[model samples]
Every structure is written in structure tokens, then in C-alpha cells.
Target: MKQSTLSEVKSAVTPRATLLVIGVVALQLLFVVSYVGALHEPKLRDVAFGVVAPQASVEQTMQRLDELPGSPLDPRALPDEETARRQIGNRDIDGALVVRPDGTTDTLLVASGGGRTLSLALDSLTGDVLEAQGRTARMVDVAPASPRDFNGLSSFYLVVGLCVGAYLCASILAISAGARPANPARAATRLGTMVLVALAGGLGGAVIVGPVLGALPGSVWALWGMGALLIFAVGAATLAFQGLFGVIGIGLAILLIVIAGNPSAGGAFPAPMLPPFWEAIGPALPPGAGTWAARSISYFHGNAMASSLLVLSAWAVAGVVITMLAAVLRQRRAADAGSSAAEAGATEPPA
Candidate 1:
């Protein structure tokens, strides 16, 4: 029997298919909203800044800089230019100004390696303020980025690649075997497999970015180790999601890593330059933590990195626990069902 076009369309798209399409649409819209909202405006918000001046003039300098419109720079008084340089290297502050006691010129110490965009913003803002005071601002690069590391974004891009590799490897494992592992052993096997993938992919990415491309200058061994940790963390989390929610878990992984994690990761703009929401969440997600750690390794002499490393560790631990628990629970349910079926058959007479 021939059917009308509308009837054929209705038959082709079941209720489940309609719902899946709706879910995809929602994710697409969220991706667009998150990326644009985080990057559209690149205004600095309370960037950590230090002022080095004589005791008598330090308070006035701090007050005037603080009073800048939008409160762009969070200024504090430092004892000497030496302290300013040390703090910038420690990543406790982004840039510092050393006000000369004898001359009208002030030296601004900025670390381009932390992020070129952020350092440039610091320069422009400080330059404008010094110009108002009729003093010249001399720019000094305390930790300039490697020439090949364009815009100092290589660290961020490398972490993003690791995250993508993590999820894709986990998804492929799920497709080849099963979304939910049948038992604890199978779940463990999947995790063990992910670790190998992490190691191989991590070393490959580190070598490419370090020696092959010269995109970043850091200890290749340190980068390789961190890369492995990041990949396993993300891959384990994806496996956990799949164990709990079957095929739909892939979407959840994308929602967390791609739509929510990427823009908020501070890859394009540092956290302080992003909006309040993105800035707040960026440090808490995998992509953000990985990006910050990578940059610390490459530029900040591995300073102030304890918190980011802890975050990645937590994700890896949680994923392992959840995946194993889900598989064990599923195994128990199957065993109980099988036992009940056998008992029922043993009591029944021939039919």
C-alpha cells in the first residue's frame, strides 16, 4: 500500500529518533553560546598586578591604579623590583611596574610566556596610566615565549589534542566491545587498555610539539608524563559515563569535554580575561586544569601547579571507581535473574 509523504516521514522518524535529534540540537546550541560568550569580549578583569615604588609613593600608586575604570588591574605594593620579578616568575602576579626613585621612567615587567594576549593587555593598560602621569613606561619581558610558540598558545592546543584523543579512544573501545562492560574484569581491561593508549598518544603528542614542531620549549619528559595523565583522566571518565548510561554516555562526554570544557579552558583567552562564569568554571574542568598545568610546566617553572594536578587525579580516580561499580552491579543483576529462571524451570511440570 502506498503511503502519503507525511505518513512516510512520521514512520521514518520514531519518537526515540525525534528525541535523539532534539538532544543533538540542544548540544549544538550550547556549543555556539558557550564559545561566543566566552570569547566575544576580551576585557581584563582584576588581573593580578604589582607596584614597586618607594614607601612614601607606593600607597598613592596602588590607589590610583585600583581606581581605574572597571577595576581592571588588582594592584599591590611590592618592596623592590626584585620581588616583582620573582613573583611574576612564580605566577603569583601577571605583570609588575617598577617605579624609579630617581627618574621619570618606570619599567614594566611582563611575562609573555604566561600568555601573550594577557601580557599585551597589561602593557596597554599600564602604558595609558603612566602616560596620564607624564612618565614613560618601559616594557621588559621577564619570561618571553619561545619564538616558535605563537601567542604562547601551544600549551593549550596540546592539552586540547590530548583531551580529544582521550575521548575518541574510549569511544572506540566501547564500540568494539560493549558500552557497558559485563563484569569487573572487563571494566579493568578497558581501563588498562586506556592507559596504554594514553601513554602512546601522550608521547607522540609531546614529541611532535616539542622536537618535531618546536612549538613549545619545555622538558620533553615532563610534558610526556603530564600528557599521559591528562589522556587517561579524560578517557577513564568517558568509560565511566558509558558504563552507566550505555550509548547515550558519548553525548554526555561531549557535553562536558567539548561544549563546556573547551571554551572555558582558557585556551583562546586566559581566565581573568574571560567572563565571570567561564573564569569560575575553567579551573574546575579537565581541559582547563590540563591547559593550566601545561602552561605552568612550559613557562612558569612548574610553580603553583599543585591544585591543577590534584583536579586531574581526582577525575581519574572517580572514573575508575564508577566504571567498576557499574559493571559489578550489572553482573549481580544478571546472576540473580539467571538463578530465578533456573528455580522456576526446576519446579514446573512438563508442558
Candidate 2:
């Protein structure tokens, strides 16, 4: 009985099944590692900061900021406070330090609308430095966040919602039909369906966040366009993954887009404040790119979003190419197999 039971267990756990189990375990470990690694430490790095002071003091202050260890801030001297405020409003700089000529106190201008965590970090860092020099600093929010937008996270959540909608919808479509499309025509049809779904999902998300909820402020049209692009890009990528790897491709998409992409997205903590690994990979992933673009639309007047848009576009293009190519190859193989079978039948002996 013991020998029979051992044989049964061994038969149940085939090599292929074992490998798949191993793969799942690896993905699980990676999910934990990626999230923890990216979010464990939040430190400032290369934050663009403006300085407003007299000609002589401007250079001196900038020099002092440059000399800080790790070079956390990229400080530039603005001609006056008005320029500093204008630049902040335009999203040219993250924050500014204005030195009072007559007193030891200074003013730090921040925009919590961009990111509350980042603004707080700037305030803390500036305050510490000023305190060390026996000076005091007051924080002024140049561009405050909307009361509905807590921690400036509305944009991030909005993007994340769109991303979820995209991948989930694509995965369902693949599952309902064949994992790999039946043929080129089927693939085209699946892609076309995805496009329409993305368009509607994008517009709906934009409307909910902008008009219905008033959680985010921006051109609703621009947000709609961005949402559409983001949804299509993610959905197409998921489709491509399913075509290439079958059911396993769904896991691969989750690993890339959810496990790795979400934390690195700078949604909870801006890229500058995240650890190095997360910060480096953040802009390349769909979630990260989408979050950045959404924030730009909300707070930056859509400035500095070209790179993000390009990244999303690349993903969409690549997904379409891969899906179509995979379908074509699959169809060719099926046709060749059928032809070979017919030839074999023709040569067979008569019963």
C-alpha cells in the first residue's frame, strides 16, 4: 500500500507541474521583494529647487545647497520671488527657498498639488538646514492641493484604476476566446474590441475623476486622451503576453504590471523620494508612466510628459506587433500540419 501511494504521488506531480509550481513560487517571492525594495526607503535625490535672493547671496546659497552630501537638490537661482512662483506654477521646479535679507528667517515655497510627500520632504530638509544655521524657515504652499485630493494621491489612484481595468479586460477577453487567437482575423477582431473598450473605460475614468468627483483638476479632454492611451497600452500588452505564452502569460503580465510596476510608479512616493532601484525602473513601466502622465495633466499643465507618452506609445506598438506576429505564426503552423496530414493520408495503403 505504501509503495502504491508513493507511485501515485509521484505520478500526480509531473516534472512540468513541478516546474510550474516553482515558477509560481518565484513570482510570489519576486512580488514581495519588488514591493519591499522599492518602498522600504524614501529619500530625496536630485529634486529641482529654486533660490531667490540678492545677486551675491543667490550664488552663495546655491553653492551651499550644491555642497550638500548626496546632492539631493539641484538648486538654481531665480531672479526674484515672482519668477520662482511662476516657475513653480508652471511645474518647472519642485520648490524654492527665499532668503530674507534683513532677518535670519527664510521662506520655502512648495506645491503640494504635485505631491504632498515630496513637498513635506522639501520642507523638512530645508527646515533642518536652516535650523542648523540658527535660522528659521517658513513653508508656503504655492500650489496647494485640492481639499478632495489627499496627499495628492487622486491622480495616482485614477491611473491605477485605469491600468487595472485595462489588463483585467484584456485577460478576460483572451480567456473567453482562445488564449492565442484562432487566426489573423481573430486577432484583429480581438484587438479592435480592446480598442473600443479602452476608449470607453478611459473616458469614463476621466469623467469620474474630473467632473463627477472633482478630485483632480485638469483639462477633461486631455485627461480623457491620456486615459484612453493608458488603457489601450496596458490591454494590448496583456493581449500580446497571452498570445505569446498562453495562460502563463497572464501571470507574466501581472508580475510586470502589478508586482513590479505599481510600487515603482511613484504614486505613493514620488520617484525622487523612492529608493534607487524603484526610481530607475519606475518611468519604464506602464503604471509608472501612466501615473506620471496623469500627474502632469493634473498639476504640471501637461509639461514634461513627452517622455512618458513616448514610453506608453512604445508599449502599445510593441503589443500590437507581437500579437499579430504570434497569430500569423500560429496560423502558418496549423496550415502546414494540415497539409502534412493530408499527404500522409493520400500515401496510406487501402484498408
Candidate 3:
């Protein structure tokens, strides 16, 4: 009886199912490793920083900052305080320290709108350095986050939500219909359905963050546009994966968007604060690009957005191309197989 029961269990769990289970376990472990590794220790390294002071002290100040343990700040000599302010607003530099020529007090300019944690880190690091030299500096927020934007994390959270909706909606379409669309028309239709979902999700998110909760302050139309683009980018990519790998593509999409993209998205910590690997890949992913663009629209006057928008656009374009091509190829193969089978039948001797 025991032997029979074991055989029945083995028959019920096929090899294919066993492989998928193993994949799930691997993804689970990766999720833990990625999140903890990127977030467990967010130390600043080579953060873009500007320095303004008398010509004599500029070089000394920059060298002092550059030699700090771990090389926290990448300091450059700014022409003046006005230039520092302009650079910060343009997102060229994360923060700046301006030393008053005749006064003992200096001013640290940080934009909390970019990332609250980053701004705080810069403030503390600069403050400690100045105190060591018997000088004091006051911190000023050049571009502040919206009062309601707690910790300046609302933008990151908003992007994360849109990304989740994108993949979930795409996965649902694959589950309801076949994972690989049968033809070009079906694939196009699937993408069209995704567009509809993107529009709805984008508008809903924009309204919630803008008028409803006031968690973030930005033009509703601009936010709506960005939100729509992000959703479509992720959904199109997910659909493309499904077209190529069938149901397994769904897992691939999760791996790319959730497991790899989220922790590296610079939500709790900015890129300069993250480790080298996560920082490097963060701007290329959907969530990271979306978060950067969202914050720019909200606080930076939409400056420094070209790179992020380009990244999202590339993903959207590539996904669409791959998905359509996959469907067309599948259709052609099916046609060829059917024709060959029919020819073989006709050549067979009549019974």
C-alpha cells in the first residue's frame, strides 16, 4: 500500500511541475537577497556635490571632501553660490556647501525633493566636516518636497504601484487567453487591451496622488502621461516575455520588474547612496526610470528627465516589436507544418 501511494504521488507531480517549483524557490531566495543587499547598508559614495568659497579654500575644501573615508562626496568647485543653486535645481549636483567669505557660518544647500534620506546624509556629512574645522554651516532646502510628501517617498511608491498593475494585468491576459497569442492580430489585440488598462490605471493613480490625497504635487496631466507610459512599458515587456516563453514568461517578468527592479529603484535611498551594482542598474529599469521622472515633474520643473524617459521608451518599443514578431513567426511555422502534413497525406498510397 505504501509503495502504491508513493507511485501515485510521483505520477501526480510531473517533471515540468517540479522544475517550475524549483524556479519559484530560487526566485524567493533572490527576492530576499536583493532587497536586503541593496537596502541593508545605504552608505553614500561619490555623491555629486558642489563647493563654493574663496579661491584659496576651494581646492583645499574639495580635497578634504574627496579624501573623506569611503569617498562619500564627489566635490567640484562651483563659480559661486548662484551656480550651485542653479546646478541643484537642474539636478546636476545633489548638494552644495557654500562658505561665506568673511563670515564663520557656511550654508549647505540640499534638495529634499530629490531624496529626503540623501539630503539628510549630505547635511550630516558636511556638518561634521565643517565642525572639525571650527566652522559652522546652516542647511537650506533649495527645492523642497511637498509638505504632504513624507520622506519624499510618495513618488517611488506611486511608480511601484503602477509597475505592479502593469505586470498583474498582463499576467491576467496571458492566463485567460493563451500565453502565446496565435497570430499578429491576437497579439495586437492583447497590446490594445493593455493600453486601455494603462490609461485607466494611470489616471486613477494621478488623481489619487494629486487631488485626492495631495501626497504629491504635480501637474495632473504630466503625471497622467508619465504614469501611462510606465504602465505600458512594463505590461508590454511582460506580454513580450509570455509570447516567447509561454507561461514561464510570467515568471521572467516578475523576476525583472519585481525581484530585480524594486529594491534597486532608489525609493528609500537615492542612487548615490546605493551600492555600485544596484546604483548602476537602477536608472535602466522601469521602476527606477519612472520614479526619477515622477520626482522631476513634481519638484525639479521636469529638468534632467530626458535620460529616464528614453529608457522607459526603449523598453516599451522593444517589447512591442518582440511580441509582434513572435506571434507572426509562430503563425508562419504553424502554416508550414500544416502544409507539409497535407502534402504527406496526399502522397500516401490510397487505402
Checking candidate 2 for backbone clashes, the offending pairs are none
* Candidate 1 deviant stretches above 4 angstroms: 2-11, 344-350
TM-score-based ranking: 3, 1, 2
- Looking at candidate 3, what is the lDDT of residue 204? 94
TM-score of 3: 0.98
Write the residue-wise lDDT of candidate 2 on 1-351 in tens digits.
Answer: 999999999999988789879889999999999888888878899898999988877898898888888888999988889999989887789999999989999999998988899999999888888888899889999878788999999988998899898999999988896777778898888889989998899899999999999999888998999899999999999999999998788889889899989999988888888887788998999999988888888877888789999999999999999999999999999999999999999999999
Candidate 3 CA-lDDT value: 0.94
Report the lDDT tens digits of candidate 3 across residue range 1-351. 999999999999988999999999999999999899999999999999999989988999999999999999999999999999999999999999999978889999999999999999998899899999999989999999999999999999999999999999998987686778899998999899989998999999999999999988888898999999999999999999999999899899998899889989889999999999999999999999999999999999999999999999999999999999999999999999999999999999989
Native-vs-model 2 lDDT? 0.89
Tens digit per residue, CA lDDT, model 1, 212-329: 9998888788889889999999999999999999877888999999888999888888888999999999888899999888888888888888899999999999999999999999
RMSD of every prediction: 1.8, 2.2, 1.1
lDDT of 1: 0.91
> Judged by lDDT relative to the true structure, which candidate is superior, 1 or 2?
1
Q: TM-scores for all candidates?
A: 0.95, 0.92, 0.98
Task: List residue ranges in candidate 2 displaced over 4 A.
Answer: 1-18, 348-351
Error of 2 at 261 (Å): 1.0
In candidate 3, how many Å is residue 245 off? 0.6
Clashes of 3: 0
